[model samples]
Target: MSSSAAGRPDDPVAALAELTEAQRQQAMRRWRLLRPHLEDGVAITRLAAATDASPRTLHRWLTAYRNDGLAGLARRPRADKGRRHFPADLRLLIEGLALREPRASIATVARQAAAVARDQGWPIPSYATVYDIVRRIDPAMATLALDGEKRYRDVFDLVHRRQAERPNQIWQADHTQLDLWVITPAGRPARPWLTVIQDDHSRAIAGYAVNLGAPTALTTALTLRQAIWRKSDPGWHVCGIPEIFHVDHGSDFTSLHLEQVMADLRIRPVFSLPGRPRGRGKVERIFGTVNQMCLSQLPGYAPRGTRDRAGRAQLTLAELDTAIGTFIRTIYNHSPHGETGVPPQQRWESASFIPRMPDSLEQLDLLLLTIAKPRKIHPDGIHFQGLRYLDPILAAYVGDSVVIRYDPRDMAEIRIFHTGHFLCRAICPDLANHTISLKDITAARNARRRDLRAQLRDRASVVDRLIEAHQVPDPMPLPPPAAPAEAPPVRRLKRYREE
Candidate 1:
């Protein structure tokens, strides 16, 4: 019989011509080994060894024999292409979307991609498909499912860890705008700025200041000095220095004068990161509550306007200072914070976190006043910020560098001293004439027009009331005739009527 036909009767030769020369030779060798084993019920392992094959290969051949008798063992028709289990095009789309919108949600991107596919008449994959593709491409993306959740969780964890149980452990300091309005010397509306330092543990406002302008380094130092002095006073019997002093990155907080004061006091000044309000969140939240509960409810309270409106209003710098003082003492310190469930004063007293007081007000002032830029007096006897000042003591140091000190709230009056002697006191100009070039002319003109209109309306109403009451009519007063001037040498004696 031919080689193709000379196979076992049960396993006839089938498709041997289709096999490659190498494969055919291997099959022939396998058949020869198995023929001897088939007669004696040979072991599958021994047969595989004789054929130079694995037990798996012997099992495959046995299964083919039982199914197709022999043809199944013949090499199956070659596959047209390799199997492709991964979805390549879909993965590319998901990765591209992720790159474009780093913060976008996976579901959101998937929906977007689906919409794009539909619009372009392409195959739209399911959300699961997109998710799997993202996971395969970038494992880190899978780990961070949401963006801000982790950060917020971390903040709370940090707060729990850092919260102080004692009052003197931490103090938060910040500046906030107050809504208390005051009438200017010129009768215009004004608001003041306030700086406050509060004990974090007790929620007590340790020190505060309401100033004409935003609190400067000098104002902050002075407020701190006053607080320390009060705490150390024998009458108060309070003594404790804070371990940490936290503040935002305001110019006052970072000024060299403030730094020196802190250093001298042995206080650690900690600054919050720029643009990261969370670092100083406690103070920021306090300001927010003050704005919402106290500031927004005040009469004549207006949102901050541009420089032009503020100038036109002739904002009262001094009166605003006084109003802020009242707000802090009467309102903030006394009022109970909802979270703390106690007034700041009560909390402070309970905690007993006061510091040692200073011996004298002069000593406190000296400790607070730091070295500042020296500005020479102008011809008008003014030093800086349009403040007209005079110092008999400053006269000796006319050309020399002398230290200047004053309350920011009461800019109208400044105390000038040379070498610690009370030299001179200067008064600020009236609000109406405060500016040099009469730039407040517009406000003055507007005020005058408003007054005239009001007066005219009142006069008309009064006349109507008189008519209704049948009162006697008051005749309108006429201007007296002008006195005739002496003739200029009879040169103007022409009479038109006679001509």
Candidate 2:
């Protein structure tokens, strides 16, 4: 028969075009198996013996190839390709068992199905057939049935990902404990927390803070301030007030102080749902990327479960901070984003849109720089957290209830406000020349208090012993004379018992 009439092809490419993808793959596989016999004249029996196929199958394939071309070697679609012969009820039962909570093993499901089939006098399916039925169930349905709604939502639920059209239209903030350990100022190894502010549109990191303490409202505020203000580094240019500040449902993010700052800046705060963190996935991805690309290369890279990770610590917090800043400016911001196909810094600058900024750094600081605490001005100064803050202006406001705002990073100085008006910046004379953090001051105060309490306990025990000594009368001195008289009488007259 001619090639066209026999549905065969003299050209391999033309033959492939006429067949579906599966058919084409099958034809290629068969061609590979028959090549030695057809081209090298190897015996058919030898080829069959070497391969998984038998001689009869080899002969059929060879004959078909000779009659037609490569097309004849392609497997034809079966009439019952997807249709199963089992009863509808049996299929449902198998699926139900497979999808039960605490999902049974495939073998267990097959055994149970076989037992049920035997009891019902229905056609029992082989294990492979049972497995195929279980596999055919929709994965989403199976996940919901076997796992739970939460797992199903996390894995299979369709998400409406949030995206910003402009660079400053949306910003996301989040905190993660870095994988690397760094030495604190006090020479202790600690895993630092990293708070990051990022532009949603460009995926550019605007500002970040590395601190030994857990993320607090002050940390978030400081990071936000850094993000909104222009950077001193010429290479890093991402800054400005965002239209929408997106964050998770963390207490720091939900603080009234943060809310007030957002209101003053005309930025709307968008919080993710209480238990749903998917909304913050964009910012969260940056943490993993940083851990893998930046931190994993650094000294003391303590990924979870590493023993003696602290012993490997070599870099101080400041050094680590500088390293992270360098990485962001030199590498991360410059690298092309996998999703955007453009470097973050380049994308952010491409729009040429001027960001909305505070009128002045002072104005921004007034809102985002410090945590506010209500303090009454004493005769000496303002007392807060066991530290005395002094200012000449405070002399006039003595005994007055005023508000003092201080940077947790520097407890040496604080800004005093009276009835919401800016007052003088007060300083602690005791903490002058050297910077002392709020945490340091607190730790010192606690240590001192503990020491005083220990002394008091010792003194209290001594006083109790003295009081008992003074209150008790001296032991009566009468017993010695009576004992001597009885011994003398017994020696003189042993027989006079009455005397």
Candidate 3:
């Protein structure tokens, strides 16, 4: 290499950029602090304020650099170097205090050490010296002593960023507890949970579930269901069975139901090592965006510490669900992502390759909702939790026990399985027309009570108005004649969810 090109002092920054991050950080810290002196003839007072170091210390570093090139800018070692020597007790005290369970500040330890030194008639170490000693201690030692092994690994662990070459090759699923609190079904303020499945290639949120409860295998399965099935909205076309399901080491991801479903579909499940979630960075990044972009604007956004009135809870879980749906579709999916530099929706749809999919939506529903229950088929119908389901196919299975699967949110129908084979979908006579949840029924009852009380209030006003108009009420007037009644006509209702 030529003399001019051999990492000359004039281009130290250019040379520094070529080094690794750790080495660059150490070198840059010294270079930045000393740059003002080398380039501009700046004042000591200005340099002190800029670097937060004493003038004497700045001069010392400048002298060191001029004498020994870039290497001299580093801190000078003691005669014992890494080992403890003169004022050994003080050095030990500072490092011990730094690595204590509940860490002590340099100033605090310096003051305490001064007190002990006075009693022992020994020299008291300055705060700066103590600070330098603590700062130089091995980072691994500090992490292990203060935050433990888990944190040490979290901070210093080696990670490989992995992604699929194309969409549907691999998918990532994970859950995050949102920062905003929403009103639960029980009418209490609670944080809602979110489960999202993303394409490893495009970083698109293929499917998501927002609920005010702990994440379960059901939620993940349902999310996977949405991801695999074609969407009604044409804009959202990211559908297909994924070749690989990548997820963290969560119980919800490792459930037997998920295993069975994946096995049946031939989709492999890849779990990140337990307590080391480095591979989940892509999903984690999405969650961070949600916290910053979506939750921050929400009504009940709870940030760290001093929970003031600004974070007052307002939206219910249902309302939040609608909000989340709108945000995901309109904003998040359409916006250009930081990593991919393209809108996730556009990226997902840009490809022409067909994704592998299930034969039918029914087959998907049967596999995903694994809440199967064994029930006996009676002559009248199949009996379930307080509801009787009827279907012509059940007539043949009368007096026989069959397994049934249902969605708790809707008890309008249940899928029946005879001897591990799908028989037919049986409908509940009363709730056949509309999907009904137990919570909805409870809410309806409350609403009905409210309406009756409102009617009573209206009647009271009517009585008061009549009394004011006629003090001597001319004995209540005769009721009007009844209208003619015709024979009630019989009409068949529309079949629910007709195929």
Best by TM-score: 2
Candidate 2: give its CA RMSD in angstroms. 22.0
What are the runs in model 2 whose C-alpha is more than 4 Å off? 1-22, 25-76, 185-188, 305-308, 367-371, 434-499
User: Each model's TM-score, in the order given?
Assistant: 0.48, 0.72, 0.67
Q: Scored by CA lDDT, what does every candidate get?
A: 0.61, 0.86, 0.79
Q: In model 2, state the lDDT of residue 350.
A: 99
Tens-place lDDT digits, model 3, residues 144-203: 899999998888867677878888988998898888888776677888898889898888
Q: What residue pairs clash in candidate 2, if any at all?
A: none
Please give the clash total of every predicted structure, in order.
4, 0, 0
lDDT of 1 by residue, 1-499 (tens): 1233333444345455556777676666555655554556678888777677788887777665445444445666558543224445555667777656356677987998898778767778778777766666543443344334454443433442246687667777787766556555656655667777777876766766666566788778766765565543232322345677787788888888777766756689878666444455666677666666655555455555523234434336654454545565667767787778898676767855445444567655654545643556543455667556643333334455445666654566555555556556544554223433333434544565677799999999999998999966769978999999897775666779785
Tell me which of candidates 1 and 2 scores higher on TM-score.
2
- Measured by lDDT, the strongest candidate is 2
For residue 186, model 2's alpha carbon misses the true position, in angstroms, by: 5.2
Ranking according to lDDT, highest score first: 2, 3, 1
By descending TM-score, how would the candidates be arranged? 2, 3, 1
Indicate whether candidate 1 or candidate 2 has the larger lDDT.
2
- Candidate 2 lDDT for residue 51: 98
